[model samples]
Target: MGYFLLSRLLSAAVVVLGVACLVFLLIHFIPGDPVEVILGEGARPADREALRQALGLDRPLLVQLSQFLQGLAQLDLGTSLYSQRPVMELLAERLPATVELALAALLVAILIAFPLGVLAAVRRGTIWDRAASAFALLGVSVPNFWLGPMLILIFSIGLGWFPVSGRAGLSSLVLPALTLGSALAAILSRMVRAALLEVLGEDYIRTAKAKGLSARRVIWWHGLRNALLPLITVLGLQLGALLGGAVITEVVFSWPGIGQLTIESIQRRDYPVVQGCVLLISLTYVAVNTLTDLIYGWADPRVRLGIGE
Candidate 1:
């Protein structure tokens, strides 16, 4: 167990380092001048030069990279080009909103997907199964970019059920969460149905049924529990995607989260903030996958033994 955890942690660290390097290089190589964006095109050359020097943008690329990495080693994310605030402070302020949005979206997906998936699997060829399958297809087919606006138009503009945008209260979260979770729910429902169907055919499941356990007990306790292994894999992977997807949802709904911050920073050519945001997101993805691996060991003793070896 210790060996497995250590190896996973080491791999995660390497992935994060690679992500940081790639994000830094790509953001710098992008055709934009932070100084120009900050001072505007009409600014005097001398003023631009002074600002560039002050921000250390005048330094060589390698020097800047080294400095950035050094700061990272010390747990410092550097200062934002535009706000002049520490990147860590900015992340601290914005991370909660993104976390809230991600968790809410996951909850919505699970609540909708699990039951529908189980029902679809159990009913197989019934009309209810067909309807559930259709719902999954629609969810997967509709992109969040389109879904978000349509939702705003119907629920907020026409029906006046929820606020159009911004985060004021729980009411504000409803639209964004729905928009973000809909596709995930769709994908997850299909996975659930498939995994449950497979588990239902296993020898142990037949034994449980033959032992006179009620159908519901056999399906829920025996079937669903075994089915969870695959479901967990899907959920873990999708949770990472949810964070990346939040960027688009945040923009559409004007949510004050890390995604929104990242977009704003990119527009301003704020390197530190953008780097910080990407690094944080990458770290989160790695962390979630690692946790998923640990859960795999916990869910199946065979997996635990394999890890221990």
Candidate 2:
């Protein structure tokens, strides 16, 4: 187990390093110049050059990349080109909102998915199963971009049940959370149903049933407990996905999260901010996946040998 964890951590570090280098190289290749954006086209040549020099934009690309990597090693994300604020500070301001939205979406997915999945699997051929299946299909089909606007139109504009945009309170969180979570719920429901159905057919489950245990006990304890291994894997990975998906959702809702910050930085050619945001997201995604692998090993010790290799 220790060897498995150490290997996973090393691999995670390597992935993060690759992501950092890739983001730095790609952002530099973008067409617009941050200096040009910061100083209007009509600005004097000396003025533009001075501003560029001050922002370290005049340095060679390799020099800048080296400096950026060095800063990262010390947990310094550098200052934003446009804002003149520390990139890490800006990220700190926005990280919580993104985290809140992502966790809320995860909660929404779990609430909707579990019972529906269990019912559908338990009553395999009935209308309940059909309804659950249809819901999952529809959820998967609807894209967040469209669903976000339609939800705003219905719940925020027409009925006036929720705020249209921005984070204010719990009521303001509902629409964005729903928009982000609906698809996850659909996918998760199907996974749960499938996992549970397979577990239900196991010999141990049949033995539990034959022992005259209550149906609820047989399903929830015997069947569902075993089914949880796969469910945990999905939930862990999807939590990371929810953060990435929040980019689009945040834009639609005008929510003040890192995703929105990232979009604004891109539009303004704020390279440091954009790079910081992507690095943060990539780090988070890698970290969540690594933790998921560790949890998988913990849940089933037999899996640790495979994981360590």
lDDT of each: 0.94, 0.95
Cα lDDT tens digits for candidate 1, 26-55: 989989999999999999999999999999
- Candidate 1 has which clashing residue pairs, if any? none
Error of 1 at 189 (Å): 0.5
List candidate 1 stretches off by more than 4 Å: 301-309
Off by over 4 Å in 2: 307-309
Q: What's model 1's overall lDDT?
A: 0.94
Q: Provide the clashing-pair count of each candidate structure.
A: 0, 0
lDDT leader: 2
Q: What value does the lDDT take at residue 177 in candidate 2?
A: 96
Work out the TM-score per prediction.
0.96, 0.97
lDDT of 2 at 36: 78
